[model samples]
Target: MNYNIVMGTDNKTLNPLVQQIYQKIYPNIFKGSKDIVTELFLAVSYDINEPPVIDLSQSVQLKKEDFQSYYTSELSEEELFLDVQEEALILNMLSKATFQACFPNINLKLKLKDTSLLNINIKVSAKVNIQTSIEGKQNYLSATILTADLEIKDAEDYKKYIDELKKYILPLLIHVLNKDLLDKIKLPALTFKDVTVSLPIPVVEKSFVTAYSCIGARQPDTYTSLNWPAETVFAGIDSHAIETMAAIPFPLKKEKEFSWKIISGHVLAQVFNPRAFVIQADGSIEGKIDAELLAQLTLKKGFFKISFGPHGKATIKATFKPVVHNGRLLLTVKDLNIPKLDIDFGIAKWAEYLLKPLSFGLSLALNEIFLPLVSAILRQIEIPIMHFPTISFEIKGITFNIDIIEAKTSKLENQLLISGIPSVR
Candidate 1:
């Protein structure tokens, strides 16, 4: 009955996911800065795992100093998440650039003899400055590399190469970060894991209503007989309560009854039916009765009445239509048919007259039972979760209404898929 909203990165868990992204971007980084290797005419092979491990730890927290906007106080959590910090973004961008420039044209085999081949190692670190502006709902992110240092191993004059590449590669790196990467960056939505909610059983106590009359009453001559027998005739019953069930064509059983008096006899009719049903997308329910007749009734007056007429068996088929009340979907019994009705005894014929009413009552009761149950189940449920790519930080829950971002659902052979994109604010 309660909701919790949590937003933060699990840095330890995200390490592997982040590594995968680096692996994907590694080849492209080398390709973009390939000139760095071609200029020195040095052929060398490198592994992506080597040197300059990226630090994404800073992306988890938001600092007011990180945003260069005067409206920083006005930003909500969602906006802060969307507006990625400029320093962290720039540092990560420069890391990729430095990585590509330092390790280039890897996997090269050298075949020079006697001349000791100089082995050189390179490591890079940087200082970055950024400016952010918001003009008419458009956010602009740009950065300048204040200083970039390249540490070299086994080479005394490597500083010159470091200074040269700094001028060439830093500008290109910053340009791509602002124009390509950050330009497309968006705030992520929140998502939830599967949630289960318990539902209450849907049913009303014995509340069926019916009317009866004295049809087969034994007549006494004058005032001679004081105990006159009367076979209570149940003319009709309110099936509206049962009609409610036609919407959910599922099989359900309940203790049902109608109370009435016939002349001098008190008649109690107990109706019971057990049915199973399935619901289709178009709001139609199709189901068949498990036993003869939609239900059987026991009529009694101090043990003098009968328990279901003899040979009263029927193959009843039922259908239900769906309706939406408030914010929930509920079912109503639309139609009931007795394609096969078997009346074995003469007394059983009387029960057949009340079959339609009986069916309607059952349907109505079913509808009442399931309407709120279905609604509650849907309201308390949680949808499939979504997270930021690779970093594994969740962005938002799956939603249909299109706002700044929205998610769409697709069904595919026992699977549900939700995909979406965030729109600009």
Candidate 2:
């Protein structure tokens, strides 16, 4: 994986101050403890995402007199000065300091080129560096002490440090990336027509049997009274009943070539416990229908119908023209009604919220009060019935051309007869 780090606006401006603070507070932060210095070094190194890759080559030497005399001794008593640079200590604190300040919120972008090689990039700005001098003196001697000095070699090292830091922060980065992508993308819509459906019907049979037996009297002859002798009787009967049914296959065999217009739309019917119907997307209506069947099908011109409810209760009826041509059935419809109750419920509220909030409220109120009444009416209507709601759309007619292939007896006995068509490629 290749990784890159770019500096944010704040880091560039605050870096210098951070350096100065670290230098001045380093000794105090350690509280005169040697182990404190070691810990601080390790902490900074770790903060930069790079654990100590190399062992300390040398111990950090602290010049007590250089820093102590400035804070504890007075130079005003005597005009005293001395060369304190020799006593000034040089510690490898810059690398650690830089790593500590930059590691936490470092922005890293990584890309994988291949399996073998990894590249990393980092950018950082706004670095603050601070230097301070302490004055101390002995009789007739004036001395200036250099307190602290720290530096980061270059941007490349900073980039490297950031790359190392990513090992620990990669999970967070991935999470952020996913959230951002999800917010920007939209799910695609499902649309299509030419739907082939299969249904199953079962056939079963039952039977019963009867038998008879007679008991004979020992002293038959004249005392038998000519009795028929009580007889045990058995009877039998037979009946046929449907048990389980496999799916009935109908390939929508084209009976004739025909052209028809769908006036309304397509409907999808579903049966639940009770029953419910929904209108699916207009785009879902598409099919090559037999023209003769289209004419035979009774659908209001320019309209489509579909109904469904609980218990697999469903009915899809549309009016179009069915034409017979070359012993083939062609059916066509302009509109389609696909029951999409699930989708409609979600979209209804969305539309109300988006387009007309007041109307939405009124619609909700009407539904609550009249929904049950409408449902009762639907249940009472024995014959297949369709309900229509007004919707505005440009009327674009669709035509379906189908070829009738063959007719066959449905596996569901004589109850269902089906014509099969060759599968469309």
Highest lDDT, which number? 1
**TM-score of every candidate:** 0.28, 0.15
Pick out the ten consecutive residues of candidate 1 with the lowest summed lDDT.
200-209
Clashes found in each candidate (C-alpha, N, C closer than 3 A):
32, 86
> Model 2: what TM-score?
0.15
Q: Candidate 1, after superposition: displacement of residue 172 in Å?
A: 2.8
C-alpha lDDT of all candidate models, in order: 0.31, 0.22
Location of the lowest summed lDDT over 10 successive residues in candidate 2: 237-246
Best TM-score goes to which candidate? 1
Task: Candidate 1: list runs displaced more than 4 Å.
Answer: 1-4, 33-52, 56-121, 126-149, 154-156, 174-187, 191-425
C-alpha displacement of 228 in model 1, angstroms?
A: 83
Model 1 RMSD in angstroms: 24.8
lDDT of 1: 0.31
